[model samples]
Target chain A: MTKLFIPLDSFAVACGADTIAEEFKRLVADRKLSIEIVRNGSRGMAWLEPMIEVETPDGRIAYGPIEPGEAETLVDAGVLSGAGHEKRIGKVEEHPFFRAQTRHTFKRCGITDPLSLDDYKAHGGLKGLERAIGIGAETVIAEVTDSGLRGRGGAGFPTGIKWKTVAEAKGARKYIVANADEGDSGTFADRMIMEGDPYCLIEGMAIAGVATGATKGYIYLRSEYPVAIDVMREAISRAHQAGVLGASVLGSAHVFDIEVRVGAGAYVCGEETSLLDSLEGKRGQVRFKPPLPAIQGLFGMPTVINNVITLASTPEILSAGAAAYKDMGMGRSRGTIPIQLGGNVRHGGLFEAPFGMTLGEIVNEIGGGTASGRPVRAVQVGGPLGAYFPVSLFDTPFDYEAFAAKDGLIGHAGIVVFDDTVDMMAQAKFAFEFCAIESCGKCTPCRVGAVRGYETVKKIIDGEHPAENLVLVEDLCNTMKFGSLCALGGFTPYPVMSAIRHFPEDFHGEPMRVAAE
Target chain B: MVFQARYDEAEAAEIIGEHRHLEGPLLPILHGIQERFGHVSEEAVRQVAAALNLTRAEVHGVVTFYHDFRKAPAGRHVLKVCRAEACQAAGGDAIAGAIETALGVKFGETTPDGQVTLEAVYCLGLCATAPSAMLDRRIVGRLSEAKIGALVEEARL
Candidate 1:
């Protein structure tokens, strides 16, 4: 039977891919067509979603943004033979969006069947785990250290160093926790990975388990991502059944089993300590550090906590060799980063590239500017905690250090674009509001200061002694920056301060004040 | 009208018992209770606290800390509108006003007729097609006034 590929991923389903899939199935059954439908993950070019691929002699031909009603038209136009039609976008590989990406971590995402173990292995999967098991624990740590891989989750700390700490820390039962509480706005790379190639995560976590001698692991996922939770649970069960997980992994002496823990809609749970708290069936609040999670974590044992991307990226680093992974990018940010282009961008999706590209190249070149066809005003790199950059800073390269130099962050590499119509002051206010709502109420600066910050921003917006309120807002931000225990309150200043500095005009006047007005 | 099931102590105990063996079972137990009953009642919290050997305050604190947990039953349909940066950049602020006006209910308020409960969420990760909303558990993206109106009407029916 001829293979027909369609994405059953959440993004595709949200964009009506399910309806299209159903329509295709109906057509196949009614017409007695010799075609088998394979559900795949999204290609990350979300604009072209409901993207259908037909395996032909010329390779997989692409057609997309297809509706259920268009199935008949596609069939009539001989889509089965890769015949050209208005909807046909030619070979999938040649598409500029796909061509531009240097997909390392997401290599098998759109190409292979997500849940199929055979499909995963066929596309160079488990090779890393196989190699890792052969090299043993000490060598695996050394290889990771040599690769200079840093945590992809916000803080860019050296991943090898963290693993070494957890490896050496004494405990009867050490734990490896995969922080999947991805609450950041303009970010979905983690979600995509979990839903796409879950085995890679399992493989990555397994490598950590073997390297660190941890027998158990837990994935602390957010409740918002119901689909991810379901997919991961299924994937873990499959892995256990296939002997890739549980006792005697891959028929080796090592044993590692994983559990899925769901967070109850707390963004603060994304923080390492807070995640641990939530994992332990308590309130998702930040814990005071000095006895950092590496040394003493999760049930008072040494635990290795790494973000989803950081863990998912490990298999390739091991299989491809450290030097090969190290040679890809500029500066300290080695290896490819999956940049999620979102918000008002014309071509918003997940774009994986090495870290040297400038923001202007990403927003204007890759993203094709704003979807509204308006002039780009500002872009918020990272999540809500990241600073909003005016178009003037678009020349900044997509590096962690480079972004930090400008008081910005590359947190999760989620870039949210805004057109000229945006009001920076309102964006600033929302940051404070988000912090206040999501704060775990563990520390006064984040808990109380955020509320004060929100009120201060409102005062400025109300034009109540605008200059005085601005100063007050600055003071409150400084307190929160210095006093908050975690990034929740600390980095809330990035958006607030950046807005006041870059777009003073918006704060100087009444609410909804535009630059032109 | 909104469906409100009276909290059953026996049912809560069974749900709690099912998850008690897990490493950290309180969250799963609480989630299970909420899932079955639509909301976690004060009585359920008391029972959970007793079973877990924790204070009532501790259980209450956990429930209130997270946004997903509800203290009371929601309307027939819960409509969560995205109010994050991505949605805001795509006219989400304006859409918020439009939705509130159309439904005659503000964010976090249930409609008087109990057909819809409006809530504001940070992001739905549907940034590519911004101005997204979740009606029940289904995400609808690239929203407009007409589309939201149709969704509200469908929910009402």
Candidate 2:
């Protein structure tokens, strides 16, 4: 029987794919098409789904965002016609968007059954966890270290270093945390991981637990990812029932349990310390450093907190052997990162590539320029905290050191591309405004400076006190950068500074000509 | 809007006792009560306060901290328009303007009719299909001027 996988991602919700899925099953039965159609999570490309992939002798042939009218023709066209459609953009793998990626963590995304453990297992799912359980924790960490795995969440910290910290920490009680607070604007890779392959995250956490001697784990998820929360909750309960969790993990004495704590909307909570605070049922506020979360975290216990991509990659690194995983990237940053390609881009989705691809290749070659077919302009990497890199910096490699050298951070590897029509000034104002809104209201510079900065930006845009306001904005940005308590305030300058420095023309109140017209 | 904040000592204890039988029922029971009372009631707070061996202030502290755990009633309908960059890029600001004009209420303010409240949200992850809005908890996207008006009309009935 041909297995028909229908992606049930949020885009599917927007596209009304659920009704289509039920109708599809009914139609298949009526038509007596010898096929098995399964509803699964989308393949990350939101524009292309409600997209159906029909199993054929050759491979999975695709169709739609399929309208009811086209469903019959899809099957009639040999189901494997892999028919050329406007949405197809031709072969799935042939598309530069997917081709540029090295999808180790996201290998099964949009391709396999997101809800099926059996399909997951068939595609080398629990194999890494199996090896980890078979060999024990120390070996698992070693394999990860050898694979050169780094946290896919911004900061690019070595995953091995994190696991080792918790593994060696002297504590009877330990905690494993999954940072599912994907607060970055252009980022969706973390959400995709949580939504699509939650099992990978679970197994990765289990391995961390067994390796580090931690017994309890918590996945601190943002409430925005309601679907992820629901799916992960269901997956956790199933894992518990299957003995994948509890006292005997995979029938071993390594007893570790995991729970999901849905975080109220707080961007600051994405920070490890704030996340810990929120987990303890406290306000989603940031705490001062000196006691790093890995050391004294979550009820003052030694905690191993990692981003979604880090946990997901751990399973693959162990299963595929370390060298194979390590052979991808350059410099200190290694392994694959599932970069979220989005915003005003033509071919947008998730691009999982190594650490050293150029922005030009990514935005132009991979993304195919602007979504509206305008001339390519600026691209923002990282999150809101990241700088706007003009075409001048497109030659800059995506690695940590390379980007940092150019005064930008890779952050979570989210690339937001914009066309010439984009207004940098408004975008700059929004950054300060966002910081003002989400700033947890902890410290003065961030709390006061953000709103002040927005006001100054408004002044500049209104063409009031142009010279003085410009100076004021710059001075204010510097203060926020140096004085703020956290990245929320400290890094708001990247956009503001970049807009003023690289694209000063944008902030000059409509260029005098456009407004008059 | 119905859920009240748990404020007093005895009330907190009562609240905790009320939700004791639920399965790992601390958050759910608290949320349920909060939903019903606008915020967790004082009685509920005190009840939860006692059951968890926490102080009344502690319970209140947690409730007030989370933005979702409201201390007062919400309008009958909440129209949370996404203020994320993707949506903003796709004309969210224009949509926000139309909403403000139509409802005569600014962001984070409720209507006098108790019918609606408008608030700003970061990202709903509905960027690919941008210019989205969340009516209550449902994510609604591909939003335009006409769609927003139609939605308000539908919610009226």
Fnat: each model in turn: 0.71, 0.33
Query: What is the TM-score, restricted to chain A, for candidate 1?
Result: 0.97
- Encode model 1's per-residue lDDT on A235-261: one tens digit a residue: 999999999999998999999999999
Candidate 2 residue-wise lDDT, A1-517, digit = tens: 7787777666555555766677767778898877787767667666665677766666766666665456656555655345655545344676555665788888887777776787778888888888998888789888888888877778778888888887877765889999998888778777777777878899889888877888888888877666778888988888889888899998988898998877777788888888888877666788998587778877787899899888888888878889988888898888877766766777666778887888898888877787778887788888788899898888998898898887788898887777788889888888998888788888899999999999998988888977688778878888999998888898898888887777867876433221111
DockQ of each: 0.76, 0.39
Interface RMSD per candidate (angstroms): 1.0, 2.8
TM-score of 1: 0.97
Clash number for candidate 2: 35
Give each model's clash number.
Answer: 0, 35
lDDT of 2 at B81: 81
Model 2, runs deviating above 4 Å: A29-35, A67-91, A509-517, B1-30, B34-47, B50-57, B99-105, B111-115, B145-154
Reference A-B contact fraction recovered by candidate 1? 0.71
Model 2 interface CAPRI class: acceptable
Q: lDDT for every model?
A: 0.89, 0.77
